[model samples]
Target: MTTSRTYEDLVKEAVDASVDGWDFSWFEGRATEERPPWGYARSMAERLAVASAALDVQTGGGEVLASAPSLPPLTAATEGWPPNVAKATALLHPRGAVVVASPEDASLPFAEGAFDLVTSRHPVRTYWPEIARVLRPGGTYFSQQVGPASAVEVVEYFLGPQPPEVRDARDPERARARAEEAGLEVTGLQEARLRMEFHDIGAVVHFLRKVIWMVPDFTVDRYEPQLRSLHARIESEGPFVAYSTRFLIEARKPGR
Candidate 1:
């Protein structure tokens, strides 16, 4: 007869697993998330094909950039976390990309107008001035960013309701304004709300571990009561439901 694992067993498994890179393969069957319709990777790849020099900021493990079918002559990626920096270096070096270890919130290290194109996927925080500084005149900045109130359902489930300010932290309009302030014109902007489901408590644990910004200081011991309650809910319900908000933004520096 088959045996079902206990909630503790599942949570422990997730906690012990390595979340080294940006890879989410471990959640294959345990969780599901709907992707945006624009196909960000494909769009970025198309832009990459035509650019002569490009930079990918906050590149976690270089997974997205490395996946491009072709890279520009001079391609570089910046990573904040050390583990991810090493991981990205390993993954991108062979592909003719340089991985720079940069501070999470520090100014970018490149010289002024160094790249013809700049891209980022879900950057922790957008540095509009820095982006403009690093891009040549007429250069484009393309990115898919986390929108306001993204995955708040899961967040509130663990931490209770949050203030409006916290909920609207990543507003797309604010991003547009910032880009404009930095002398870049916003050419395209689109937002989407996608579905997310967690089939088991372990999936939740893994997600929290990987995406540290979700809970900030999430811990199994500290939130055991809430975790247990959520475990019971998942046991009864088919799956826990949440929504992920994403926004695609394209900005350009003036002058051809």
Candidate 2:
């Protein structure tokens, strides 16, 4: 059986990997913060208030359902987020929240035209059509996502060499087009670029350990020696430069 580390150990190990004591206040502080522009929640509630049903697409930790008041019998469908939804269901006591953890790419549990509105946060590209399929015509689809430039290339550069393809959400325009193809009207779209600062290379490493949202299959094990070697080089060469990221995307489905 696989063993799990204590929360304290987990944190410490993550820090040790980074080696450099860095300021991580931003990530640490917002560790539990929901994605911004809560317009999607408001829109979901508004639409569900009118329609009979709604779905929280790939509900993570059930944060959206918990925060939105009196949502119309919010039903959640997670393609592969079993543990997440299980924990989320405990916190967000919607009237009915079903968990369907499917390994195969498929539509959420509901039938076609099942919900009048659908919402997702940082949804993978593979699921876009599924989101459109399950929503009723005139139903809105809302989502927020990490952009392509979301710390992947930089992290790879620092870590040395690259692993297999990491799963990613499509760029905003492509996602919007997919929504349109699915027969939903695109209404709202926004992007925000934030330059997150890391104090030093160690801070970057700590960020990776603690908050690395990269794919689950991603591993630094094979490259650990190289990373250590690079660290030594940086130490000898002088201060390592720090950088940040570009704007990620957000979009909304318009009501009929």
Candidate 3:
């Protein structure tokens, strides 16, 4: 008897794949997501050009920072994951940037007023007080964050309906309030809900693996039933449609 390739096989393959360094290129044709109207990379590049010193928190592989046309004289990035720290160091060292391995919740290692600009893309969680402490007077903190209920459709597929409070946990307004409390003046805020599509079960598995927060405690064994159901739905319904929410926020410390 010959065994046919099943959804379980596809999911297992994805689960075993590497999920390091925040790169999403593996999903090229398997999945797609709309970009925000305001280009985050472009905006970050523009800001990078003028700042004298900068820090990027949670710099996953330093891919985005390395793409900037030019970096400031002194630039540093922090990564909580060791794999990402090594990857970021290898990628950024050539660009004259330092990559520090730090825990996500630990205090920033740099001294007070060390950087004129601080940035992050999809940071796990923003440490507002630490950001304020590291930024010089008049320094800016710019980031593109995952907003409330981001990718809820995908999350709900595995876990069922989430409570309103759980869905609203990452609300932009709450973030703004925190920033204010940290003594940073909110300068710019923008939010967008972008379309996302998963063409195959493998793509969904890969995504859940890479973005662990999307479906906390996800495992091929644990979610096999749900994954199989989703695979069947995709086979019959074309693709799995979901929405991702993103927010761009810029906060500035007082004084020149």
- TM per candidate comes to 0.98, 0.65, 0.96
Give the alpha carbon lDDT tens digit for every residue of 193-223 in model 3.
9999998899999999899888889988898
Please write out the lDDT profile of model 1 over residues 75-107, one tens digit for every residue: 999998999999999999999999999997999
Stretches of model 2 off by over 4 angstroms after superposition: 1-11, 15-26, 29-51, 94-96, 159-169, 199-220, 225-256
RMSD vs true structure, all candidates: 1.6, 7.7, 2.7
| Location of the lowest summed lDDT over 10 successive residues in candidate 1 | 1-10
User: Mind giving the per-residue lDDT tens digits that candidate 2 earns over 135-225?
Assistant: 7766666666665456554466554445443423436676667767765667766765444533234433555654445433334554456
Candidate 3's C-alpha runs over 4 A off are 1-9
Best by lDDT: 1
Q: Candidate 1, clashing residue pairs?
A: none
Number of backbone collisions per candidate, in order? 0, 1, 0
Q: lDDT of each model, Cα atoms only?
A: 0.95, 0.53, 0.93
- How much is the lDDT of residue 16 in candidate 3? 81
Q: After superposition, how far is residue 20 of candidate 3 from its true place, in Å?
A: 0.8
lDDT of 1 at 176: 98
TM-score of 2: 0.65
